[model samples]
Target: MTVADGTARLCAPAPGGGDLGLWQRVIDALRTADQWGSSDSTGTPEIWAHITEGQR
Candidate 1:
């Protein structure tokens, strides 16, 4: 997950069985805290940019 500028990006592995609901809850909790926006795609350029920005 990436949290920045009051927004969050969640990139989690595909859950198996009944864990989908559990994952949703975790994402909801993160959104509640950030309140700006959210996305679940790991390939998003913005998310990757934010992640790599700190490495350089």
Candidate 2:
């Protein structure tokens, strides 16, 4: 994904954990984003919420 400023965001599989692993990868990517500097501390639950929103 590319932000308005042209920064490209990406997600990649980590090798073993499948969807659960992808969550971590996505969180790591989000944490590194300039727009989301503290994603580790703040964005995890939000991310998981979005990810699992319709599964229930």
Candidate 3:
């Protein structure tokens, strides 16, 4: 997700279309300092990437 100028752009599709809920959850996770580095530890959000961010 791209958090810029106060807006978080999650999963961009060709540029604009993306999941708003996912972005919100990502923001929440980051804001809460929750475990967000791995799928196994990120809880039920099921949104963590298994690979490096650059790889994704």
Best by lDDT: 1
When 1 and 3 are scored with lDDT, the better candidate is: 1
Question: Which ten-residue region of model 1 has the weakest summed lDDT?
Answer: 45-54
Indicate the worst ten consecutive residues by lDDT in candidate 3.
Answer: 47-56
lDDT (Cα atoms) of all candidates against the true structure: 0.46, 0.41, 0.41
Ranking of all predicted structures according to lDDT, beginning with the best and ending with the worst: 1, 2, 3
User: Model 2, range 1-56, lDDT digits (tens) per residue?
Assistant: 33334344433322334578776776676654444422245434233112222232
How do all models score by TM-score?
0.28, 0.31, 0.28
Q: Over the stretch 1-56, how does candidate 3's per-residue lDDT look in tens digits?
A: 66655444333222124778766766565454323343324333334322233422
lDDT of 1 by residue, 3-49 (tens): 78644455444444578787687556544432334345664422111
Please give the distance, in angstroms, between residue 13's alpha carbon in candidate 1 and its true position after superposition: 13
Residue pairs with backbone overlap in model 2 = none
